[model samples]
Target: MTTPTAPLILFDDDHYMYVFEDQASAEAGWEMPDEFTVGFDAPARPLSMTGEPLDVRLALAGEVPEEAELRRLVADHCRGHLRGQVPPQATALADFVAALPREGR
Candidate 1:
């Protein structure tokens, strides 16, 4: 219902100036941070977010618990969510979809 002022906050899905709150609480939650749009964009520019904001931190806590496939997909989704248009993976996908947990697949 509201955004947290805590330093470790993430995003949700409300479409307010604040990004979606922590998504990890729901089924579709990717266990990633919901970023603030203003941080990505230049304060002076309109509708433009080109780089990681000074205030935003990209690092997640601890090692990613998911398998490589899930981690990669989640990372890709996060990048696209925050930066838009994530690039091709450095390695071959290599049965990435096949590797997902049954529930994930």
Candidate 2:
């Protein structure tokens, strides 16, 4: 039997983001950096999309100096990659974040 895969999305607090069929596809499409690793973990707080506690692991170099910017970039890339198959929940997530202002900006 084939193992089930969970849907994934690249999200940002502001700017860009997108939904993917699964984590592997998302990672491949994004060409995730070697230093970065993606995994499913319970978020510190519940997220609107999954509605359960879940977050993607993004390990990168030295404390991600500009986290906000990096997130925006990731989201932007995802938006392009996820041209089709934008799930309702993911759309809601995008819309919600789009409505928000950039952090401390």
Q: Please give each candidate's TM-score.
A: 0.19, 0.27
Could you say which candidate leads in TM-score?
2
* RMSD values, in order shown: 16.1, 13.1
Q: Ten-residue segment with the worst summed lDDT in candidate 1?
A: 39-48
Which ten-residue region of model 2 has the weakest summed lDDT? Answer: 39-48
- Which tens-of-lDDT digit does each residue in 36-55 have in candidate 1? 32211111111212223332
Candidate 2 vs. true structure, TM-score: 0.27
lDDT of 2 at 71: 43
Q: How close to the true structure is residue 105 of candidate 1, measured as C-alpha lDDT?
A: 20
* Stretches of model 2 off by over 4 angstroms after superposition: 1-5, 12-14, 32-105
Q: Residue 6's C-alpha lDDT in candidate 2?
A: 38
For model 1, the local distance difference test gives 0.29
